[model samples]
Target: MTNKKRLELTWIGKDKRPKLEPRILLEDVARSYHAKHLVTDNDIFDNRLIFGDNLLALKALEQEFSGKVKCVYIDPPFNTQQAFEHYDDGLEHSIWLGLIRDRIDIIRNLISEDGTLFVHIDDNELGYLIVLLDEIFGRQNRITVVSFKQGAATGHKAINPGVVSTSNFIVLYAKNKTLWKPNRVFTARNKRDTRYGQFIDNFDAPYAQWRFITLTQAFARSLNLPIRGLKKAVGDSYEALLSDFVVANAPRVVRLARPDYDAVSGDARSMIDASHKTSEILRLEREEFSDMFFVAGERILFYSDKLKLIDGKYVAGEPLTTIWDDLLSNNIHNEGGIEFPKGKKPEALIKRCFELATIDGDLVLDSFAGSGTTGAVAHKMGRRWIMVELGEHCHTHIIPRLQKVIDGEDKGGVTEATGWKGGGGFRYYRIAPSLLDKDKWGNWVISKEYNAAQLTEALCKLEGFTYAPSDTLYWQQGHSTERDFIYITTQTLGADQLHALSEDVGTERSLLVLCSAFRGNPERFTNLTVKRIPSTVLSKCEWRHDDYSLILQNLPMAQREEETLKKKKSAHPSLFDNQDA
Candidate 1:
């Protein structure tokens, strides 16, 4: 279906906005809800993760958090035939598309102007997914498809199976391509003797034989440098030279090389005199080594242009890339042994993401939040993070792993890999109920725990208001610019209350007094936008009726040229899933 049609199906007219109801029991609905924490008053720039169907969570977030996210990385299910076990995957093709598209549309709204979204998928639906993303994020915002190696080797199959295995594609889309900058992975210069030392003979001729040999030998001997380098060349002769120099420099040795030689003569005495400049020789070697040798570290330490040292702090260097192969993924895999089903993402990958996306104190978010990788990395890197998970494994697997990170218990891998000192902690939270049910007249009657005030607060949340008072008193709407003094009171509003509210509102701003019953004709008050209670507040909520999912499911077949065109229009057209629906 066209994007225009999708928008037409989802858009709600302003006049169709729902009214409040008095009999509706919004309390019971609120009570059934549960949450470990609420970020209601906290600063949002700090990281946050909302746990629920990404669709509902996105909608819930849209009102207050539009255009706020910086970078979003989602490793969504590839929709391959492989069993996910938990999620429903057997739905019609159009249903899956509709589901994914709905969430993508919402996700597009949440990205900040400079933000980018990375969608991970396999070859199966990559093309279809790209087209869908283009439709939502705009063709102009599309970025590169980064190929990530998934497997090391391909198992033997009948037809020429000697190739390296598969790779997953990361389809990146930016809110605005002009404002997006892809993070770069750090690169190291080849320092291995096998790879680079062979090029040593390629040095300039003037510096290769005499200058190189004499300077290198003298410096190496004075510094007591490893003899291994010189062992290959002038072996016995080089040691004899070192013995001569050591004895000549020794305090007790006198007339060792030449006796009866004038101190100022242009003979071997002059050579011995110049050779006594030991500090100068050592200085030249130290300078050369510092310029040539490179050490592999988490942060790239390179030669700086500045020669002066101010307070021993080195000036900042250019930022590094995110592609980190320094720590071998195989080493981590061998140690961990893939005991957990979801398994742990490499600490190097996690650290790389953290270094690119945030700084010390910035918040990182991971909604998939398996095993608390984001939280653990963020804590070690001195960044804050919020993680969300929807399985029992959160407590059993994720929490314990994160605890190890905080207490510095699991020290070997991440610490050695990223040079991270483990510290910091986080409070966990679950999404809670936002509304209650109703009886008949939509009356705001308390059934169990929540009262009329609590129901009103829930209504405010449902209506996209960020703040709700517990007293059910008149307070200006916190989020909306047009509306002020939104109230949710079941008690009948008397003339006294209205007059008092009017007095409090004064002539400065218009008042939106919402109550179960107004004592007088609301039309008579020209300034008040009074709303009566016991009306449908969630009139815009509706089940998706479109067949977009079927289209998505059958995309692979449709894209294949060999497929029969006759099946193009069928509801479940894919040849892969041709069995009974």
Candidate 2:
């Protein structure tokens, strides 16, 4: 066999990736209702609830929101071969991989450099999902795999022998590890103890409380310096220098090792030796000290002084570990008052993710907005959020739940814990239809549904330009660079029209004119590049078809069927979707 080098997870169709359309979002004002109380002077109506397929929704968000989102928490469907009430959870292994892979790729683009992504999944696909994530986010960017306890015990444990699982996994990754920094979290103080109640006169009144920490044998040995002159002054002068150094340099907590007498061999022996050396130095400094030789076995002490004091107790907040056991259960019946039968993420869980990953007013996105748990939690936590859900529950569950959150009528889940007397709102939006479709002659053309403004904006996005229309210049729809602009129109341009446009455009800048047809021949203008509209945008992305999820069966045939048939007749076979054709 020939030696291959690419280290990645491969499936049946691993090489195939979807060419997603950068669709536009259209706000549905009729369905989009917000409470008056939630609207404050600082309130921005940028919070969105998109009702459509998440894959398409992510694509729609790409151009405007690329590298803008601060956090993403998704609870995608677990391939458990189980049927869900709103969505089908079961899919073929390869098809499931393709669907998730496509969405993951887009999500990676949507997150900022310092942003984080949390994927909630079960054991059924955990191994494969981890490998896939490692490939996309890189193995180094993979933060941790947290095992969240789902419940105390399940009936399945009785039937399945020996080490049955009652937990789900949350895989966390950052877009860039060097820039990502999770917020420090503190739990409620359960006990009160003052073991290291040392006071320093050098520190100010509010910051007087401090704890003493002993230097570890490893640390002492690592220093490899004499301890003789290190402890010249004990009380005032030493405290001043150490406190100043710690405050200025060591902002985080410093850990020191406790001497272990039993394990005094190998590396521990070096620590013991360093301790004896330090004791000898102290003995020389303080000549009148009693039992100087006998005290050599004692571990050296080092003051940390960086401990936080809250309610008369020094708080060393327990850093979040890989095993998360205290999060709320997903099986809560009345959570957010939306009884989603399957895959409803607990509000507490999402709240914890936000607390660690983002601050207030940061943009948070949840493409898999099941039961709107992410939205409810994000809103109460004062985060700006955008949630997308494909199923009909977007109306039945997500909207009502969010409305309750805005009205301060929601009293369940993390409401009491977060002190949320809610006051925020999200505007509802639906992904617009594809911009381009094939006509009866099988020629690519702009869809009839697009108006002049919509067509201009769509063309700008397709050509990698920023839409910045000016009333002074009617043809100035958008611009790519400061000197390069784009103009879009549906009308066929004749010679006089082209000459007028070129004269207005001038030689100082360049312009790309996208029209239905152009009649100017022999490279007359140097600053203008005239191109046809639909033909130019046709090969840029997969158009006309919306949904990209992998489902075994179609949803219930209702009024949506007629809509589907209409789309099918207009849509042509793109490179990505030609497998069925």
> In candidate 1, what residue range of length 10 has the lowest lDDT sum?
192-201
In order of appearance, the predictions have TM-scores of: 0.62, 0.75
What does candidate 2 score on TM?
Answer: 0.75
Query: What does the lDDT come to for candidate 1?
Result: 0.49
lDDT of 2 by residue, 225-257 (tens): 344555542335554444444333332223334
Measured with C-alpha atoms, the lDDT of residue 159 in candidate 1 is: 50
TM-score for model 1?
0.62
Candidate 1: misplaced stretches above 4 Å? 1-50, 85-93, 154-164, 182-184, 189-339, 342-344, 434-454, 468-479, 534-536, 542-581
lDDT (Cα, tens digit) per residue for candidate 1, span 211-260? 21233444365657754676555566764554444323322111112234
lDDT of 2: 0.75
